[model samples]
Target: MVHNYVMRLNNLQRKIREEELDAYLVTAQDSIYYLTGATYDTAERPFFVVIYPDSPPDLVVPELERARMKKAQGIRVVQSYFDYPAAPGGNWYDKINALVGGISKLGVEPSIPAEISSKLWARDIVTYSLVSELRLIKTDDEIESIRQVARYADKGMALLVKNMYNGVSAVELLALSRQLQKEIVKAGDYDPLDNEFITVGRPAPQSAQPCSVPDYGDRLRRGPLSLVCTLRLAGYAAECARTVFLGPPSGSDAELFHHMETAREIAFSMIKPGTPCAEIDQATRDYFESQGLSEYILHRTGHGFGVGSHEAPWLSAGSKDVLEKNMVISIEPALYLRDTGGFRHSDTVLVTEDGYEPLTTYPATLAALTLKDRRPLKSLKGGFVRRAAGA
Candidate 1:
């Protein structure tokens, strides 16, 4: 998808003029990518995009990336330093100070490194998140890119479902994730460097720990299995997660899953333009509280995701951000029980003018997720089972 980098730069420049700043210096990699569509590995070197109120933005990079930056869209000038820790007058900080020397006031992102921000010699330096604010309302190109990413995430989930079997190991699932990633690259015109594809499988007991890395030795047992697919294509990201059962869920497990699904639907029903993010989260919390399972709730109802996996307009009790049209977010309200498994399903949702649209299309129903006829296979040689061999 071709992005309108010129329009994006114009938006940031307009913000710079509105704030009465001579120039706005962007240091965050993701923000730079959003504005310039330049993808590069920002190692220890300082990379920047300085936008002036009336002129085109200037990109600063290490000399190694000078040629690449020259070809990047929406940048009018490319300045480079020889390397990090260079001579007195040839360093990145030196170039930055020289670029803004004529300007009276400068704007910087809030996430700029303290060391870099402190070295700026501008008479007045103000911290702001202008680019991030612009990103809150995605453009047509961005929405399309995110939609494409959602498609890939859904495909990854579908692959997971097809490969899931009783006694499947985390190692095998991870290998499947790699295979799916390769398939996506071959199937689309995506830059391998500009995307990320990961699938995490956590079979129960470990599924209760959402952030814990699954044990390679852990195998799918007769309990809940949580699968998450996080995909990013051409700089936009989407996530899809579902909790399935290895076999028929026990009566208590099925009841808990029902509550989790109901809570997710409640949150989904509240998604629309102008809705308070907190209200959606509050409603989910209220439902869980009424069900006498509030303590099992682990995190917020959802959070916005775009260039970054987690971005603005968070859906939590304390967030003040309200949903706006075109803002993409994840609706993942999860419950974690000790000794039991996690119960959750996540979908990438787009806020429309009237309501919302779900981008990820994986089925979330228990009947659909349950592998009723699959049973644990007998222990194979070396305690390992290849997917094809298992079949």
Candidate 2:
């Protein structure tokens, strides 16, 4: 892990030189962790990593994180403040001034804090630059990390399905998903950086977007429910989404689902080296429109993901990003109908040398999605139980 950090810094240095930048200031949580092995949430607190072409890197963090930052290997100097608002004479500006005191040009990411930027005497070179592009391609070890998390997400989905029933409320379904994720983490002895998202409800009309969290009282019917799970393992991430049906699908629902599947197939088939990213999205949309399901389309095909769930090299119409080997992205083609529900299966895919490979292993077939029980579930309202699944 430490070696990976060193290589990434070296790469960033090269980019700095090419761009004629004197120094690069990084503040994004994911970018900081990607460059150095240090990880911490940036909630309310400011964090930064400064890299210079000629000088060793310096890290400015909260005093609380000072001990943790010590464990990180690539950084040469560690500076900390007791907390936010800064202590007397402990201003980060002074440390930064000392580091790049005489520099004539400085590079910074989009999210760099105003305080730091305002104090810089050098001309600011603002851009994502090497940081964003570096994350687009995953190393062999990074890909393996994502594979493990994808498996965990698959398990979480199975748990949700096993507990699903006709009358199960959206809230209950979400609870089950969380429980399963916790169990998987303990059983596997994995670090707990995993994130799980659950969406359950009847699909809304093409004009109406469904809320990620269902209505408090909305209960599942013998229709479609969308479940999406994203699990992060050691900072590498993968996602799995499936549209499940409570019972055997009706003829109409099956046909709509088939169109959804077709769109997904179109996107998957086009994944290869040098294929323009927008073309994949455009081709999928074209297929859906040709089938006359354009109204039901909600959003773009998918987006790039890694340490951050949504990153660079987005797969969407109007984007010029071209697919490259080791670039990880999600291919999700979905349809929404007022009467039926949402039909989507999002899979994390890797752009390989020859083609693509799906990191998510969950089956997306109709038969595989059919639930066995249509049993009524107990209703719970504001801390009170009003009914049960078997009753």
Candidate 3:
């Protein structure tokens, strides 16, 4: 594992050289994890990583993370600073002189707050925007952990859809979805969720507009089409979303939903190493335009996932980042109408040299209700999420 981890760091070093950068400063908490394997929130105190291409990287952190970095392997160099709220010069700025060694050009993640960047180093430290784009791809071990999380998300979403009988309160469904996510996380040997995403059937007859009503207490009913639902299982950062029908959907509903699914397929097929993200978005947009539904695309084609539910390497026209091997992304393309609800489907795809591998393996079955059919109609258990079939 450490061998692969070092190689990943080397890949970033190569990227740094190609970008004409001398070093990169990492402030995003997850970027710290990506580089150092020392998971930290970096909230209580400043945690920073200074990576110099072809040299041992330096980590600046409060004394709290000293032992943590020591154990991550290849972390031979680290600088620790202390915080004394009651004392002067208590901030980590003193270590700046020691940490910012020989870096003429610096690459920093834009996710770093402006305030943090302002104090990190000298005003003249030529800073370039450097997000951990390489982190978007999935390693075998990383994919395994996320697969567990996505499986849990799929089950949690399934539970939400299964209980979508008329008169079920949105709050009740949301509560149930949270409960299911808790169980799935627990099953994966992790604690209950600290962060998650759960949304129910939207409020639109034929259109997919933002819910004006607080979706918390609204009762879900059979609508003009299907429901846009999602459940994020733990901050392990797995996401599952789908447009499930309330009852049997009509022909028009099925046709549109399948079209949205097709858009998703086209986008997925377009992702691979070396493909520009703009072309992928254009293809999806062109397909939607061909279907005469160009105005309904509310957002980008997709976004990167892992460590956070949303991050860099966005799959949209605005992005110029090229896809690379091992990158995991969500190619979710949806059409939302103001008259009818939306049809949204997404899967977390791992970009491979050959093509792509979808880590999110939930079946896109129109007959999802059938899976719920076999289960007993007992009172809804607090946190019983049906696991994904193969998981």
Candidate 4:
């Protein structure tokens, strides 16, 4: 999709004028990508986009990346420094100072590293999240891009579910994820660097730890297995996750899953324009509390996602953000049992005028997610036919 970077820049410039700032400095990699569509490794070296009130944006990069920065959208002035820790006059700091020497008030993102912000040569270095605030409301192209990525996320989740068996290991899942990444790159004709596909498989007790990474040799067993698929395409991201039973779920497991789904739906029903983010989270929390399962809650209900997997408009109790139309977010209300497993399903949702629309279309019903002890021949044949047909 072709993005109107000129219009985005104009919006930022307009915001800059409103704040009475001469220029705004963007140092975050994702923020820079949101503005200029430039992607690069940001190891140690400082990369910046300087936006003036009247003229076009200026980019500062390492000399090695000069050619690529020159090709970036909405950028006309490309300045480069020799390298990190270069001679007194040939460093990033010097280059930035030269560009903003005449400006009295400079705007910088609040998340900028203190080391860099401290050395900037502005008399008034204001902290502002202009780009982040702008990103909260996505444009038409961005919403379309996110929808496309969500489709791949659903496909990846289905592939993982299809490959599940008695003793599948996380390493095997990783290999499958890489294969899926290749398929998406070929099918969508996207740059390999711009696409990321990751799948995490946690079975039974291990799944209780939401943030722990499964060992390479960890294998799936006969219990609740949490499968997480996160995909990024063309700088947009979507996530799909489900807890499937390797065998027939126990009564307690089914009960927990039902409660989790109920809580998720309650939150979903509350999503709409002008709804306070905290209210949605509180309603979910209230449901879990009523079920006496509040102790199992480990994280917030959800958060917004686009260029960055987790952005603003967070669905947490303390968040002041409000739901708005065109904003894309995830709805994941989970319950983690100590020795059992996690019960959760996450879907990327778009807030609309009336309610919300789920972008990820993977099946989330318990009956659909339950797996047999062995892979069915019919399932294998179906997968083969689908692959043969180039689906």
Candidate 5:
């Protein structure tokens, strides 16, 4: 009752009916959960959601998940089969075909199991890859769930800031973030980590940015100015980094951090409904130019975040999608020097009828707590992060 899987079916049905499709094969884990409330992750034994727009959503799961699928209340029909480990003679494709036959138009997530999809294609059928566009704007429930995740993120960021000072390594801070309270993130029954996700950096040198395992080293120190972007909690990735001064930002460090924060402010200020994503990007770049820090603008403004950390409706140099209500995003226009480090302001934002809602409220603003006092790293609640309303 809490999660109306029927709503997803309703929307998908409208699309399918318009195109006169019989069924849509959904292989993506998120898509399955969004449509059936039945989630499982066993790549060896494939599971899929075969949604018949006209009828109820059916699930094709393995024998092991049969009882669980049968007990599931949302999905009305479910078909179980023996999978890869011992499904030699069993033809699961045939079952899939039976459900998909006559469905002239089939919709699938962009990232599907290539092998399975290739064999499942029909000559007379229209297979649509509705990803970025389909997920462009989130529903009210989706928005609320993400907002809940942001609450934990905001709390986590606050904890991180409280411990900010000399001698704290990036690795330590990263570890500390993992140790903060994850109450709000897990509150809505959405498990983001166990779900398909990603967390990486956009380091000064792009190569070091996306490394799954980075030798955080002494990359964070009391010098230059560094920004620490971390994916701290579930269902959300806090892609914000700061301009830390080696021993309290001063001179060039202070100057750079100030300009970078302004750049981010410029971008955040431009976040309104109907604004072009690319134009928002240009606004940030222009701020950097105004400060004569163009060369330090390392990455494309920012990107979309949801079930996957990096998604569509990206805020890049040439994106064309207009910002819309309930579309959550993070705008981190930054400037970083090679060994010196960087400065960035990133908040998980929800686009509103007016401006945007900042999910995390660490308040890394230049004037807020640039060179604040630092006590020893204290034990934070929930071991991961805290709640953030807005800042």
Candidate 6:
């Protein structure tokens, strides 16, 4: 892990030099974790890590978190403040400027606090991120971590299916599945960094918007339920989602489900190195339209996934990124019918030298997802089991 952080920091420093940046400043916690192997809940506190071409990387954290942040690798200097609104010597901005000495220009990330940004010495400050594109290509160690968490996500989905039943509310289902997934995460020595959204109802009308945890009151009777789960371990993330039916699916539901699955297959076939990222998205959408489901497409086919839930090399209709080996992306081909629910299963994939490799191993077949309520069993005096009243 220490070696990985050092190598990534070096790569980012090289990019800073290429962009002619005097120094690069970062505030995003995930980006910091990517470069320093430190994970924490920043929670309104101002935390910063700055990198330079010649000087060692420096970190400024809250005094309360100083001991924990100190354990991270690749950071040459650590400065701490007692809290926010500290005096002159206690401010992170002041310490950062002192470390830079006389650098003329500074590159800052998107989430830099206004309090600190206004006080920087650089007159020609630019916006740049050291971890965005660099995170697209996963190292061997990163791939392993992603795969491990991906497996945990798969288990959570299977548990959801086993527990799904008629008249189950969205909140009830999500709570149960979360409990199950949490056990697996702890057993694997991992932690939950974000919420898992499970929507069990008719397709949402707003398809272009972000997916959120469904309202607890909406009951899922006998139709389709969409489940999306993301798991993270050691600062790496893996996500998988699927739409399952409570009972046997209707003919229309079956058709659209298979169509979306077919679109995912098409996207997978076009994931070889050198293929245009937009081309794969266009191909998937083309296939969906060919099957007469064009109106249901809410957004792009998928987005990149790694330390963060979404990242670069987006598979959309207008993307300019070219597919490169080792780039990790999600292949999600989904559509939302006005009356019916959404249909989709986002799979994390890795572009390879020749083709792509699937990191998510969950089964998305109709049979696998068509869940029925479990029947109770009764035992007789001879210890023989028989179907209960409901069965």
The residue-by-residue lDDT of candidate 1 on 1-391, one tens digit each, is 8999889999999999999999999999999888888888887988999999998889999999999877678888899988998989889999999999667899999999999988899999999889989989988888898998898899889877776777777766666667667776787776766788788889887888888787666787678889988988788899999999877899999999999999999999999999999999999999999999999988999998889989997999999999999999999988999799899899999999999999998999999998653434433421454444343
Quality of model 6 by C-alpha lDDT? 0.73
> What is the clash count of model 1?
0
Q: For residue 219, what is the lDDT in candidate 6?
A: 51
- Residue 208 CA displacement from its true place in model 3, Å: 3.2
- Candidate 1 TM-score versus the reference: 0.94
Q: What value does the lDDT take at residue 234 in candidate 2? A: 70
Candidate 5: how large is its RMSD?
5.8
Model 6: residues with Cα > 4 Å off, grouped in runs: 1-3, 87-89, 110-116, 177-210, 375-391
The per-candidate count of clashes, in order, stands at 0, 6, 11, 0, 17, 1
Q: Please provide TM-scores, in order, for all candidate models, with all chains considered together.
A: 0.94, 0.88, 0.78, 0.94, 0.80, 0.86
Which scores greater on lDDT, model 4 or model 5?
Answer: 4
Error of 2 at 326 (Å): 0.9
- What does candidate 2's lDDT look like per residue over 297-382, in tens digits? 88889888788777878888888888899988999878887666788888888889999888887888989988877354433231
**Candidate 4 — which residues are off by over 4 angstroms?**
375-391
Candidate with better TM-score, 4 vs 6: 4
Local accuracy of candidate 4 as per-residue lDDT tens digits, 1-391: 7788788899999999999999999999988988988788888898999999989989999999999777678897899999998999999999999998678999999899998897888888999989989999988899999998898888889888877877766665655677777786677657655668888888788888877788776778777898999988888899999999987899989999899889988998999999999999999999999989999999999999899998988999999999999999999999998888888899999999889999998999899999876556534543553444343
Candidate 5, which segments miss by more than 4 Å at Cα? Answer: 69-73, 85-88, 101-103, 125-134, 181-212, 216-219, 224-241, 289-292, 371-391
Native-to-model Cα distance after best TM-score fit, residue 312 in candidate 3, in Å: 3.7
